[model samples]
Target: MHTSKLIKDTPTDRIFLFVLYIFIGLAVLIVLYPLIYIISASVSSPLAVNSGKMWLWPVGFNLDGYKVILQYGDIWRGYMMTIFYTISGTMVSLFITIPCAYAISRRDFAGKKWFTNFMLITMFLSGGLIPTYLLVRNLGMLNTVWAIIIPNAVSVYNIIVTKSFFQSTIPWEMQEAAKVDGASDFQIFFRIVLPLSAPIIAVMALFYGVGQWNDYFNSLVYLQNKNLYPLQMVLRQILVLQDMQQGSATGSTISQSAAQAAFSKEQLVAVIKYGVMIVSSLPVIMVYPLLQRYFVKGVLIGSLKG
Candidate 1:
């Protein structure tokens, strides 16, 4: 090993680096401020939140907002519904996307170019919402969980990313060796390709999971039944309508207590609103840490390949 002498940065270089760090610091603060404010508001006393006592940290810290939000039965039901939709939808999406991407990545596959063009065409062109809704209705999928999960299951964008990953990350030489050992196409894919494709799979799971979790528009359009409503829809109802149906359903004991709280009902509702937003988003937040290591690598490799 050779040791290299250190050269100090020139004054001009030092000045530029300092300026760059300052700019990056300001950008980070700009992004982090709102997130901190939301978390502070969610935990702060209703009066503290409404009076703007909350800043970077919570003032008059209390859990009343969370307590009130969690008291709702519908919130729990919505949680269950969203969990089911996220898991089931992600599994379905991965099943379709992974194989399709792998197949398209293989040079020997027939109609590869045509299939790629077809997927791209659908990506740019859609039948629009009206036709999509009509199609779902005609298929008798409307008002069911299938309407929410099935219509948008296979994302063309994901297919492209996964295909790029397979092409770049999985070596053709490995597949050839497997074939030489009398492995069929299916055996090679299952035994060899998939094992080497964990990074992309994790990335796809994160993408699909987050998309399905955050989705509410599909639920609103396709599912009229409140029982089938996902967390986002339920949160919307609570935030917008200030329904407090949960408290009322539990009887006047809870309702009277809520009314007797330190802050007025509307102010308290405002506090609960922030808590609901945080609660609704918590799952996706938790998921990010697990997939973050793979996300960048997967995206970079997948995008850079031919």
Candidate 2:
């Protein structure tokens, strides 16, 4: 009898739920609108794009923007460099961070508290950019890939999170059992702990990978050679050059028809910016879903107990 009353009450609750869902849908559209505009603008002709004729879809679609971008051989080189950096940097970061986190997670380790405190101190303080630059210069890492990867190999925040996860999730008894089986520390870590700790490791890998992939500031600071420049730096230069050439003072050098052509070129460049973002982000974005099932459990298990 009470179940029927509750069922009747659920209809009123569902009405409110429907209203809430509608608001959320509107919010999603608002967030997605700019992305939609960028895609549409990239495919649309310059005239249609600049005139604000594009809505949610392409207007008189064209591929000239992609053609122009692909014509630059430097962009292809930048793409390859970025891929290499992202992969190598993530691997190096994980190697450093995972071991450090694991060591800290063990309560029996002497000076673990002091080490953890030292790491926490780094999170709040730094040697600053100039000092770091000098250090890198002294190490002769400048203009090399190590300048980008080695300096940022161990993030304190990531270390803390990962350590917490390990402490909270991995049982001490398991390590003891592995040791009883004559497993070395390294063997136990790799054979037992690592397999069980997949979620947090995956999370850390994603964090480090994305950070390295999107990092432009490090490349800008350390890399002097254009040949060593990553995709972001190249993109920055392309945008700046496009802006300068399209400026009013420079526009006067060209005839009216030429000015129009230049404006079209500018629009195409603007569109390509969005395309580049899409291309660069697509891999990481696609990767997350495959690991998504593990993310929540990993975070929860790793965070709560530690």
| Each model's total of backbone clashes | 0, 1
Residue 272, model 1, lDDT: 76
Q: Write the per-residue lDDT of candidate 1 for residues 58-90, one digit (tens) a residue.
A: 988878778877777888999999999999999
**Evaluated with TM-score, which candidate comes out highest?**
1
Candidate 1 lDDT at 289 equals 83
Overall lDDT per candidate, in order of appearance: 0.85, 0.78
Q: For residues 1-306, write the lDDT of model 2, one tens digit per residue.
A: 455433364787899999999999999999999878877777777767777887779998776666556656667788889889999999999999999999999867899999889878988899999999999999999999999899999888788888888877789988988889899998988998899888888888877887888888999899988788788877676656643366542223222323445554456656666656665566777887887776666566545645
Clashing residue pairs, candidate 2? 165-302
Query: Which has the greatest lDDT?
Result: 1
Give me candidate 1's TM-score against the actual structure: 0.92
In model 1, residue pairs whose N, Cα or C atoms come closer than 3 Å (at least 3 residues apart or on different chains), thus clashing, are none
